[model samples]
Target: MTEIIDYGRFADRLAAPRPRWDLLREFQDEWGYTVPAGVDPWPKWSESEHHAYVRALHEEWTGEEEDPFQGVDRTLPVPKALDEWWDLPFNSFTYSPRLYWTNPEYPLTLRPDPSGYGVSEGLPEPNPFVEPGGDLRLCCFMAEYEYCNEWAYLASEAGHDDPRVLASVGEDGWVLQARSISEFFVLLAAVRLPSHFGWSVQLGDDDFPDGPPVRERIEAAYRPMGFQNWRELGADTALFGGPDVIVRHDTGMADFAVEISGRSRDALAATARTLGWTWDEDLVEPPRKDEESQ
Candidate 1:
């Protein structure tokens, strides 16, 4: 059986510095959770503000005349430290076909917190994709990307026997990252809060120093295909051979070129063609004169 890690004890772990992934995995295994794929760095807001915003959303979604949070104790049973964290923006794993409810007449009125990535749940209609449970409701959403945005939520079952769950609704319900909303913030922060907090993923050890130097290559080869940050697309695939290191684009564009560098044209070309991308024969720098002389 997976051992249950006490929430307070986990907070102690977060009090220390360490790799985000390591801490996240530890939490997941101990708490029986998993997070979404990508990260969104939203800004922070006060707890009252968050609750107010969500209540407003519920009002908007249901077109209700009454206040949703009025006289209602929709409080979560989590550590006081975690509760305090709800003020920060929502930083969650990515979701596809980004979901956002825009009010053209008053879009800015219900705008996300200062970081511009806060998610608020107000819709009375439950997401059909998510299985019906104890008062499952949308919490907030990440920035929109690839036609959709990832959203987080709270369920009644959350914090009961199960840890508070903050999940995203996709084709498949991603319940893996379910933890008290406080835990969600703590996990992300423990790893490393994004500089933009609500705009991007935090940089782990692998992203720094010299891990996958695919960004420059992507700009050179696949920028036209709407390729942007490495975190957004994650690592597609890495090829090692003539070009030394070749990175493929995961930008969902068929014509994106394979990144290339090195003098081995024939080998690189063969590999590119086999992989179904047009090859850049000129990618290889000319062999150095000293090497040529050898």
Candidate 2:
């Protein structure tokens, strides 16, 4: 497996190596699960955990412990680049990227996402970018929305070794989401990790009406990760990092939207205080003393 690019500091929070990975390899040795490459994406679950996870899923649908990947056919040659993206593990159960890894052959084995767009509707097909009647194959990797799945992210099924990323915005048609699958993954991480992990605040144009002054304040509070590709917004998307979290500033179609996050309450408080944003959420709340905790 090749080293995953940070992609302007987007992927490090999601795909960076962790000390827990060593313990995961030990579990694989004990359970006979394939010990993934050192550089491969981290496993979302342990072998035993996955077995139970699969069983629960089967019980939900089949009321039986049937193998989902049974008799699956691999008609399309899976690209090495895509395989790497597929191997990376991330939380998907709720409004996140819940990856599908089963058999019974999901068509060309590319609809690895549970989105209705890929499995049920197959709405964006044959590649609209290609000339009419020209051959085009797409691999839908993920679909997400605030609630139901209404968007799709796909790539070329049989083209470029590391396919460029595409997105289907319901009826909005397809747009170039990223230059490569790796960049797409990091972009997803950059947006998702901040809101999901530390204490976060989402700001609007009012807060970031001016650019340089706001950026200078943020830069003073955190280290810069770098800008990433988010063409959907039609502007630059930059990310910054504190000791353990990320702050993303998006200047796109909707104008400026900045999210500041930190690993701990103290850190988040410090950041929010420095920015003079004391809205009195956990970000600014000091930890209670032991006696106050009761």
Cα lDDT of model 2 by residue, 1-294, tens digit:
122222234334334444322332332222122322333333422222333455587679977665433322245554455554444342221112222222111233233333222332333455556665543445644444221222223333444665666654444555667655555555554554445444566676466443456667776766555334444434446777655456666665435466766555555666666766646553332322222211
The deviation in Å at residue 185 for candidate 1 is 1.8
Candidate 2: give the clashing pairs.
69-103, 69-104, 92-97, 92-98
lDDT tens digits by residue: candidate 1, 176-270? 34334444434333222211111111112222234344445343333221111122122232222222222333333222323332223343444
lDDT of each: 0.32, 0.45
Q: What CA RMSD would candidate 2 show? A: 10.4
TM-score, one value per model: 0.28, 0.49
Worst 10-residue lDDT window for candidate 2 reads: 97-106
Q: Top TM-score: which candidate number?
A: 2
User: Ten-residue segment with the worst summed lDDT in candidate 1?
Assistant: 97-106
Candidate 2 ranges beyond 4 A from true positions = 1-75, 88-137, 145-159, 170-172, 207-238, 251-256, 282-294
